[model samples]
Target: MAILTRAGRIELANAIKQKSIYLAWGQGAIEWDTQLPSEPSSSTELTSILGYRKATRVLYCDADEQGEIQVPNGRYKIVAGPTPHLYCQFNYDFNDGLSKSIRELGLMVGTKPKASTPSGQLYFQPEDIEQKGTLLLLEHRPAIYRDQGVRESFEFVISF
Candidate 1:
């Protein structure tokens, strides 16, 4: 196998980072346990698009807790998972930034279903929407790296 240099890895990582939708349990919570708004999120109580990607701490990814990517939905911009993000810590794990598993609940990443379909966008489980539990303190951040981390701001998308 070929080895990636630090710069190469960052470039590759950044390139792959875009085209993805991400969610982290934010400092707020949704207490009603409701279904995700299948309609345009504008009409729902989804959190505003501000303060996303502000978590400067390094996020920890794991083997067991990887994302469940799904096929393309005519609905969302990027299609992926419908997994229930039932849990995640309210604050960033500031210890070492190299934790094996994340403190956040479920993490959704990977491809939308199809041949040659792209990967990395997140998806919501229709059943998990409005299930009547506390809302996960969610921070929806999409990683769209224009210059691979040198862009003005990181691009995040709530849907898809």
Candidate 2:
């Protein structure tokens, strides 16, 4: 048997923190309720991505939710705990995926910009990018219908 050291885990967590990360949402399939397959860890992309956007924030912290917090600067003290973990947050625009039934979401890493991509654009439609990046995380669930004037937010905690 083999065990990875805590220092190794912290290094891995820091490596991921330095990369470009995005949260991608997809419509998936209409029959997802009855047919969505088990989430394959090897999946490179969502079944049908409507759009994606960069993470709003990323945090490096320890297991007890200590060592790091994204509160207003100087508002709280920081403490590095024993175990390492990452917290990522994303916010979607009201018009994104509007009138669509979204049933899948993924966390992407290392997505690349396309030749025609405009400068400083954060949100992206599928056709706007080159590579979709490695699919670092995947989720499939019951459909959530998007309506006008309604926005969405997603948060994920990844422990290494």
Candidate 3:
């Protein structure tokens, strides 16, 4: 699959909203739920895109909890605030071997999802950290990468 361009993202988001589809994440018996308006994501997508497995689950937190809970293929809505954006946090528990593989692959740690606006320009903020129960409004689009890349991309509009 080809990388998603700016215009592609907007077209995808519009399609997702019209369909009100559910995005799936993860593979091999592991998958997470997805929020509408944002792209459909899964652990499998992250594993392939980032080129690593062993990511146990993604965590969502807020002012209430620091490390709250673990969600398998979890999905949540985006809530708009002072800064409007969508966000999700994933927690990885890599085994010894997998950790080494990641480093070898030059996969950077703490790399968040690449996002863009309707115009297709990348947009994000430093404070857009993933928190539990933080609503992430998303715009869903077609998957860009092949293999796991087939997964749809969602642009975060706001966080609750």
| Best candidate according to lDDT | 2
Whose lDDT is higher: candidate 1's or candidate 2's?
2
lDDT (C-alpha, whole model) for all candidates: 0.27, 0.79, 0.26
RMSD in order of candidates:
18.6, 5.1, 18.4
Candidate achieving the largest TM-score: 2
**Which regions in candidate 2 have their CA more than 4 angstroms from the true location?**
34-36, 65-83
Over all chains combined, what TM-score does candidate 2 have? 0.84
- Model 2: clashing residue pairs? 67-79
Expressed as tens digits, the lDDT of each residue in 68-146 for candidate 1 is: 3221221212223222111111232223122222222222233123333234312222222222122222333232222
- TM for every model, in the order presented, reads 0.21, 0.84, 0.19
User: What's the residue-level lDDT of 112 in candidate 1?
Assistant: 29
Q: How accurate is candidate 2 locally (lDDT)?
A: 0.79
Off by over 4 Å in 1: 1-3, 24-104, 111-123, 126-160
lDDT of 3 by residue, 1-160 (tens): 8886645654543433333111222221112223223344321222222222212222222222232322233334433322221233322322212212121111112334223323321222222312111112222232222332133222122122
lDDT of 2 by residue, 6-29 (tens): 899978878888899999999988
